[model samples]
Target: MARLAQVTSSRNREVVAGFDNYADAERAVDSLSDKGFPVEHTTISGVGLRLVEDVLGRLTYPKAAGLGAVNGLWIGLLFGVFLALFTTNAVAWFAVILWALLWGAVVGAVAALIWHALSGGRRDFLSASQLIADRYEVLVDPAHAERARELLQTSQS
Candidate 1:
């Protein structure tokens, strides 16, 4: 369980610099930090967001089964180790782990096959999704915005 802290939004923030991408905005903030500016007053925000999905390749039945098996293998190993830790019979540890691994692979393959068949070939490709922005802006508290801009300008020179 991770703890999260929430702070109220400041209304007096001002944008000191804007960049075409996040890397440039990040560098600007880093430069301010290096120049002994109070970087805590700054924030990087993305503008004009877009959702992009890149298709990696086609997903076939064999590929799906292999992916599921790989995932199941790791899970089986974890469960086996946990079970072996509590068991009193030392000699049966290897046997228990091996059994779990074999069953996990078989079950994983069958489950994947069933899921693919149920999908009715709607989505048969692998892809990754990302949210991108057209530009990134570095904002600072109103009081420190001018100093931040000055430090960034000096560093660039």
Candidate 2:
């Protein structure tokens, strides 16, 4: 938190205003420009997401990772075998394996959720990416930053 404060303080001459939607952001910029205030906005991609995906995909999808796709699949297979071997219910090995797969998927989903929550910033978790691919950022001259920020804030509210 202190580090964030430092970085923000360094930009004290600049003011940041967040918008709920793109249209509101656009309106703010248009209004500022009409009032003879310089307003510039930009979008930058997040490379962290791509990097994380590359590493995870290689580890999880590697042919050498497991019997086929996952190194841990064998563990699930073992559990499945145990299920098939035990219990006089007479469950097929295939059914046990399917159950194991479902269990593995659930585990993976939970891990992903935790990871996503830990990773900061606005992100679309739908993608197998860790970082933002696009964002709308604005900049204004120091002298006009206050007015621009106020206008943007009011518009957003």
- Model 1 C-alpha RMSD to native: 3.5
lDDT of each: 0.83, 0.51
* lDDT by residue for model 2 (1-157), tens: 9766644543434435544445555666687667666544322112123234533332222222232325345556667777777645545656777788767655555555455445553442233544332333455556666777777666557
Distance from true position, residue 69, model 2, in Å?
38
lDDT of 1 by residue, 49-130 (tens): 9999999998899988987787778778878887778767877888778777877787788788788888989899899999
Off by over 4 Å in 1: 1-12, 87-95
Which regions of candidate 2 deviate over 4 angstroms?
1-13, 20-23, 40-135, 154-157
Backbone clash pairs for candidate 1 read none
Worst 10 residues of 2 by lDDT: 41-50
Q: Per-candidate TM vs. native?
A: 0.77, 0.28
Question: Which residue pairs does candidate 2 place in steric collision?
Answer: 49-130, 49-131
What lDDT does candidate 1 reach at residue 59? 84
